[model samples]
Target chain A: MASAGSMAAAPFWRAAGMTYITYSNICASLVRSCLKEPYRAESASREKVHFSVSKWAGGKPEKPNFVPE
Target chain B: MAMAALRKEGRRLVLSSNPSSFARSAVFSEESCPFGARSVSTQIVRNRMSSVKNIQKITKAMKMVAASKLRSVQTRTENSRGLWQPFTALLGDAPGVDVKKNVIIAVSSDKGLCGGINSTTVKVSKTLFKLTSGPEKETKYVVLGEKGKVQFLRDSKKSMELSVTELQKNPLNYTQVSVLADDILKNVEYDALRIVYNKFHSVVQFIPTISTILSPEVVERESESGGRLGDLDSYEIEGAETKAEVLQNLTEFQFSCMMFNAVLENACSELGARMSAMDNASRNAGDMLDRLTLTYNRTRQAAITTELSEIISGAAALSH
Candidate 1:
């Protein structure tokens, strides 16, 4: 019952909707992956494991005994 | 009136006589033909480059996504390997019984373009059907994916239970499998339960693994592939629960977990297969584009040379 004009437009509308849906799904998954760690910790009440913070040795003496005047 | 009519006819005749020459003069005139060809070809090359770059960007993003999924799935598969071994071993230790009624849950991907992952599972299922048929034997099917459901319904002579979950979209959750498992447990009665799914071996290769869940005797028997499942330990009596309750829970839990694991493994296989397929497609597209550009260039060059010869001839004709 649709006219030719509307029929031609239908495919474009459908394609636009599909792309939007796909993008939204991908975005939602990315967001979920991002917040997964925090969500897991809060739900389980599990203790957080910490990693050792290492410091590098001081490079060279600021004054190398031959100081610039 | 005759002179006016003659002049009009003369003009029409002059126009008709030099149609090609007029077109040639307009298009390939004093304006350098090489310049036109060079500019047009450059624009085309630039356009193609941008499109190819866009494709590369998209493919790179997909590759990264596939890698992340592959990592998580591999970890889950390794962990479940330990779980399936003990559960299957326990079943093996159960009393042997004649399995006349068989229900095989053959899992395949809903989506296509996942290489041979689905086909391998189908092949194994077909083999299972051929091997298990006899005069009085009854075999049923519980198909997990759309593809498998359709295929079995068309070709399979036995009754099949199809489970389709709404949550089969991107980032699949455990609910899909749980729904399927519940439906399967409720409707069908089969002495032997076997599941055919792709077991992830590597990125390129996933072996079709068919594991028998019911008829504990089959579980006890080592697989033809000679993969030995370690011996099962006796159930330790926990504080409050009776052995009967525990065993019942364990059985349900094991089945649900196994189904869930199979679906996840299938998803991983599907993605991996698609990723590889797309990778090849993108590469082929690049190759095609290269060939097209070369052809386009050659066509443009030949056009320019023809134009140059025409202009020279036209100038010579004008001088004469």
Candidate 2:
């Protein structure tokens, strides 16, 4: 019976609201899937400044030399 | 069902016994061939049915996967509204840009498994083409999706060149849009421009939308916003001398960001469409499998019942 009701109403639902509803749902799902928080990381170079969104890559830093006067 | 199968065979065997002795021998040869052939055909049919049932299992699994993907994407889409709404509102009816020509950059998906998502965007592109392709100025088309490429294949023959089937490699990032924007802007001969895309509305809906990045039509579309653009024109530039340079830079920046946003929006929509389409397909497969299984069981039971009844009758006749 439920299936019969659905069979009768499917065309109407498709015509009236389902079209927009489906389109909107698809868009909403796409947006929700892509957006994300920025990852955390330390700056790699002396010229670089750390932003909240960045993640640090691990590498050895150069040793500093003391100047003799 | 088993009883029915035995009965059908028993009836056939009983019918075979009614012939004369010589006829019975001939009947055994002729009748046995049909019975064996029928059995073989039924077996082949059963094999086909099982293969279809296996396909249904695969489809059912895909449906579950799509459902999970749908859930995650739905949540992400909901949060994106906060990010985009402010930027779009501030964009405020493309400040009156007067140009002899105009172009609309349309983004669509390369892959199609999504239901009507691609079709809706293509339909909008067609409308835009009709709207702009007047005697006043030539209308140019730039399509970002393969679906668009196919849609406009015939239309490309008309006036201005139509770009179709061009797409960036995946894990689609902002850089791809920048490159696409550069390609578009380089070829653009238009004074005014606009972008038409799908705006994410919900898990099941997307609004076919046109947003003006630059247009003189804003006066026609946004009668109220025209007054605001006039007010902001005075304060928009930094110094008198640098006004042109600053305006150019700002306009380019906004254009790039807007274009990038459109591409991202398109990508999300494509995924959603595919997921939904797959979901529906899988559900249909499951329903078909259920029906086939019912038929298979009935057929198998009927065959079994006929064989059982024939054996019982043979035993009674020997005892008599």
Let me know the DockQ for model 1.
Answer: 0.01
**TM-score for each prediction?**
0.59, 0.62
Stretch of 10 with least lDDT, candidate 2 chain B: B19-28
Model 1 quality (TM-score): 0.59
Stretches of model 2 off by over 4 angstroms after superposition:
A1-69, B1-40, B57-91, B94-100, B154-168, B215-226, B240-244
DockQ of 2: 0.01
Highest lDDT against the true fold, candidate: 1
Worst 10 residues of 2 chain A by lDDT: A47-56
lDDT of 1 at B115: 64
Candidate 2, residues B1-320, lDDT tens digits: the string is 63354334323323434323422232234334454443312444455455545554554565466567556555545554454455456546553344457676677777655668877887887877776666777666666666765665555534324353434343443344444454466556655666777766654677777756653233333434455444445455433324333333344545666765666666666666656665655555455445545655665676688778888999999999
Candidate 2: C-alpha RMSD to true structure equals 20.1
Best by TM-score: 2
Q: The CA-based lDDT of model 1 is what? A: 0.55
